[model samples]
Target: MILRRFFSSSFRLVSSSSSSSSSKLGGGCHRDGFRAVSSMPEPCQSSPLSDDESCDFDWDSLGFGLMPTDYMYIMKCSKDGKFERGQMSRYGNIELSPSAGVLNYGQGLFEGLKAYRKRDGGFRLFRPDQNALRMMTGAERMCMPSPSIEQFVDAVKQITIANRRWVPPLGKGSLYIRPLLIGTGPVLGLAPAPEYTFLIYASPVRNYFKEGSAPLNLYVENEFVRASRGGTGGVKTISNYAPVLKAITRAKSRGFSDVLYLDSVNKRDLEEVSSCNIFLVKGNVISTPATNGTILPGVTRKSIIEIARDRGYEVEERAINMEELFDAHEVFCTGTAVGVAPVGSITCMDRRIEYQTGADTTCQELYSTLVGIQTGTIEDKMGWTVEIS
Candidate 1:
């Protein structure tokens, strides 16, 4: 099989953390009895930042921006080797060779998840195993090595705990954890890198869109296609995001919240938004684009589907035509960043269609249920949450 190229020279990693706090955060525990992986690195024993409980940061003003945390997790392996151990490092800039695979070509995959501070003074992670599994799939497509599910979850726990003070208070926001797997080794020709690196960082964030909790207004772009058949569109590779920036930028310039893309070959079928999955509601039926080698199967999308089905809604995973938006009673988007966001309007060509955005709408209900389960207010009947610390 012909593997994808992985190399790049100059790239600085960006990550997020939680909010301000005075006391240090506690440890985490995996649902399957997995303990936090301790690093033997001496320097990592103490945080680069102060241990004071008061971080002098405002959690209420927290937006979806990068706020540096105290620590980060990192592991490395060779082309023909397996990842043995990873360690905690001070969160800062990382140097790479100009010919690194991730810099030169583009062999990298990333995953996004969040940690919520429980009401009872603890922390919970929402289906991190799903993110881990998704990262592995992306790694295979990007020709990169990935950490095991256990390792991935363990590292996430470690990173969150290390930056526990940054985690927002209950109902405030959340700690957004970002995991990156990239080819770090130097390479000149178009081939896989000699070495790989798995890194994890975090930031405290509130709403992803500047509109906050308000309904989103989307613009459909027929000229710009997100992904086609047999492409990396199905995976969460780093390269997949850059190409959509143009479309997203254009949409934002037009005062739209984001861009919704159509399939490359069929142009009439809806694929997804720039970074989330789209869904439509009519009566009691909910339909989303099928993830058939094109759409990125979002964790939030999967959870919402299961929740909607349990609530006695007929959920269909099929090709959604552009015309369906006009006939839909309600429309929404799902992703790790956006959550369950109601779509207020969809502008396609000269036609603009609007949908319901009330509290009783399907998207609102799903968002309430999803957030409740994630924050531990509602019972996790699906056993989807893992308590860390």
Candidate 2:
């Protein structure tokens, strides 16, 4: 299930390849000039799996899991602040030192986005620029160098194009893109790594939660805290996620879709869900938690805020108490994975509160609008969709 694409040689400081004479470091790998740094084969020049070959898998059975595609894009940066050229490679395993910074000190970051197949047979990315900016912020916080917004966006587009055959058919699913930045260099003490790896991989996926379009059941977790103020909560560092696994696993075991986390300081204000942002609808008003330091600024959450406001609904970004959420007309969660999911009920301290969820609900309307824009069925007046063929 874990497929990776790795070159032959490890991280080393080397001069640019002869074919990359016009290429420059710090931006991105030029499409025509890119070459592998080691004695590995020229991956960029290689073509992806043929359409017939890629059709071996059942697209309908695809879930939100890793089923590696044909190619992946990888690049590296050294301690001297110079980024080497990037290259595409066949999918497989990567070797890393036991004392790697990411292994010992958790010096890493990652991003997630998706590519939707348009009705016209082309592919389009949904606001990848936001993910690029978020990754840059995470990199700065994690004490690592990052790709520029331009480099990040370009790399995503290149990899999507290279693996275009793996993209699911229209209305089937989307190609989930994961861009990871890890400290590959060894580190004995507690400091940044001497080198870093920036890689992107794709997987065809459907819904995040098993409920799909059905309403979700959430348990309010008052025992465990997700993130604290002035902590790594504001940034999407790799270190911020794993600690919540036990709580999420427990919640799922109890038949709940996910757990709703409360603010660490007050333990009363609603923070966010395990992997999504929380939103509450009261009549014609829609409100979400203000991203102070604990909540992640999700790309889908941002889009929903704008979309709701444009639809003549008053949107508020402020602290939301548990009592307010229990009394809201409608409740939902938003993220890249879970587009927009309504909350059927919430169990807080053994007291259950339920809300109405149906096709005509606010969350469903928002989900439809967002999906329409992403799949190119609706007009993208905001210029959010970026077409890639």
**Which candidate comes out best when scored by TM-score?**
2
lDDT of 1 by residue, 56-156 (tens): 56778989998877667776663235664666665666777788788989988899999999976678999999998998888777776677787788778
For candidate 2, the 10 contiguous residues with the lowest summed lDDT are 14-23
lDDT of every model, 2 decimals = 0.80, 0.80
TM-score of candidate 2 to 2 decimals: 0.87
RMSD of each: 10.3, 6.4
Q: How badly does each model clash, as a count of residue pairs? A: 29, 1
lDDT, candidate 2, equals 0.80
Q: Which residue runs does candidate 2 get wrong by more than 4 Å?
A: 1-54
My TM-score estimates for the predictions, one after another, are 0.87, 0.87
Cα-based RMSD of candidate 2:
6.4
